[model samples]
Target: MLLQRRALLGATAVLAAPSLARAQAPSWAARYPELVFAIIPSENASGVTERYGPFVNYLSRRLGTRVTLRIANDYAAVIEGQRAGNIHIASYGPSSFARALMTGAQITAFAIETNLDGTKGYYSVFYVKADSPYQRVEGLRGKNLGLVDPNSTSGNNVPRFALNKMGINPEQFFGRVVYTGSHENAVIALGQGTVDMAANWWNDEQESNLLRMERKGMVRAADFRIIFKSDQIVNSPVAYLNTLPDELKAAIRTAVLEVHRADEAAFNRIYEGKQGPLEAVDNAAYEPIIELNRFVDNLRRRG
Candidate 1:
């Protein structure tokens, strides 16, 4: 059944090719001086800004187009910016991307942070402390679980999807649940024993960061173990305003995707203090997320 679904999704991709082609074509128009990219505050504004400001500046100089990193205080603020068409591009987590596009935003590219040569998806990890007797999610059957947020792709949707597949319904699976608001908070909640298990998005880059922190005594990886992982979906994508001109959109895409190979330093800076370089991606890549949203929404309505 999974393979058949994949085939159907592939067919959808092919069927949508013409429309995508039309969207890709360039138009004759003056380029904008500044491209405002809204970033979700994954951490506190000060921490993220201190880490990422230099990267945006690097992008500004490299593209010869000013790139300003606008931090949204929360997810609602981010979505509002999309609705206003003031945001040019943004890196939205998979589920967040679905909500934004579903409500009326246009996604143009996805970020490729993984080292895999061709893959662009990430996992949703269910983590518990190392010493916890809980070995699997089933053990937490009636315990509190920490979810990153309702709109988080890997944080909420993936975990719910996995739970449902296992013949468990998340709404009733856990005794109680709470939203941590950020992945970092979810991790901390699990560490402090405030929650029996924490749900979050885990990628190679994130794993490495956690390990680095562990090594530095910030947190210990040995203290936590992954009990679950969900089917991969396209990583958070960079979305654009739906009303943007074709030419201007193409130029913006070209600048971000094409310029990376030639300027490594500038590209890496966008990752802030951690990773390096982002790969080019498109809207078609997020089909699974779109499908998931539709499926989940229907399930909710039926309930």
Candidate 2:
């Protein structure tokens, strides 16, 4: 009887071992049932969805979790969401990402957009209507100027840095400065003659606001003239909240890096790239923007 009881006890222990291991195992889905992916509203919300829906769906499949795209109303909304841990992943403009870091947002950049030539940066450009008398930054003096957003690197920071380097203070140089709210709207404002001049991003290739607008019939490239263009500012970055588990973060990075391989056309269109893959990035990539931000802040305080 004693031998039979001992054998039965051993079998019971073996049966319970797998269940115990299953209970102790980590479950990413249980910890994070869903992730909120936020994008800066460089364009309208609907446009963002239309442009990124497929990419987001791909990410959801890759991560084996639900990924919802959240179109932020403005740059600050994205920054604040990440800061509050509400946004798990975000695509941020250079200046906005710098601001997020400067303000203590717990996030880390894992990927950045790249061009076909493997270049990972773009430029900031100042534009005026082709027929406008303004031929240069100086020509726009005393005229209304449109800036996309304060936190926008291409639309605001880079433009301010370039103008300051040229000894041109936008506030004092222009009759009035207007925030058009987005790069797309800034272009629209310039085309509609709402603002005499506007600052935005230009890749100098097929990937630029001008080209995007031209493709959509919103504005003709011939209808606008580039007055000034700044040197290469790194393209926007894709970041994940730091609070995420290490395993999940690694998976997220791997998924994004492989996205181009899975669907090159969709990836290129989503990022406005020239058929290039997403590349790994770090905070060091944005050191220039950090310095630029400091310079702009000083200029603002003095002004």
Candidate 3:
């Protein structure tokens, strides 16, 4: 009876071992040990740091979690970090968000940068030197057009989509196409006449870059023309890895939307204008972008 009882106890111990290990297993919070959010810097690192450091620290305090801000040198690195699960949350351009979702990241919230006629959406504007004689989209024919990046929604995808609507094949439409890697670089290329035209995301005509160029006398409202514009896309999204726990995910979603109300000034700088409060959203909201991508892909296939 003693031996039989011993065997039964041993079996029970073995049965309980897996549960014990699971109970002791590190949680998402434990494994990460902290929360990190990444932002892609269009400006120089120093400018970004000076502009956003205080805001980052404030978010850390509010969330009651250790928070670190990561400034990616370029857009791809930002998305790649999120895809690998090293970055917990990110502010992603619509195109970047699309790419992240394709690779399995989940979008939880999006910012509304402006109130255009009481609606929140932004568009990509195609810019050319103000002095250029090109008056319309068709004028871009046989002229070099600068594209910011292959993955850029405003810089690449929107222009291509706009071109398609104009019945022009983007690849064959421009005399030459160059990718400048960022919207800032694209603007520079256009200002310096390195390319005949470039695309960028903007809401207000009074944006800093537009004002700067006008002040420099390099380009003016009359100097450049928006050859094409695309439908309003929901602004950049704050995305998370699918691997994150639902509870933690819910918390992040709540914080992003509520943080604006908690600290308005910091939120304004981080968003780069009147990019006001965030709204709860999910990946499905970007179905239009996905469809646009597919249309572009199909055109490539047919061509």
Instruction: Determine which window of 10 residues in candidate 2 has minimal summed lDDT.
Output: 5-14
Off by over 4 Å in 2: 1-26, 272-275
What lDDT does candidate 1 reach at residue 181?
74
- The lDDT of each candidate is 0.65, 0.82, 0.66
lDDT tens per residue, model 2, 168-281: 998999999999989999999988888999999887657688888787777788988888889998988999999999989998999889998886665866765544788999
Give candidate 3 regions above 4 Å deviation.
1-29, 106-118, 206-223
Better of 1 and 2 by TM-score: 2
Compute the lDDT of residue 11 as modeled in candidate 3: 7
Q: On residues 1-303, what C-alpha lDDT tens digit does candidate 3 reach at each position?
A: 000101000000000111224454445545555677776655445555656666666656554556677777666777667766777877777776776666555444444334434455778888878678887878778888888766678888888888888898877988888988677677778878889988887766655345544554544556566766678777666777767788777766666777678777777665555455676677777787777767776777887
Residue 270 deviation, candidate 1, in Å? Answer: 4.8
Say which candidate scores most in lDDT: 2
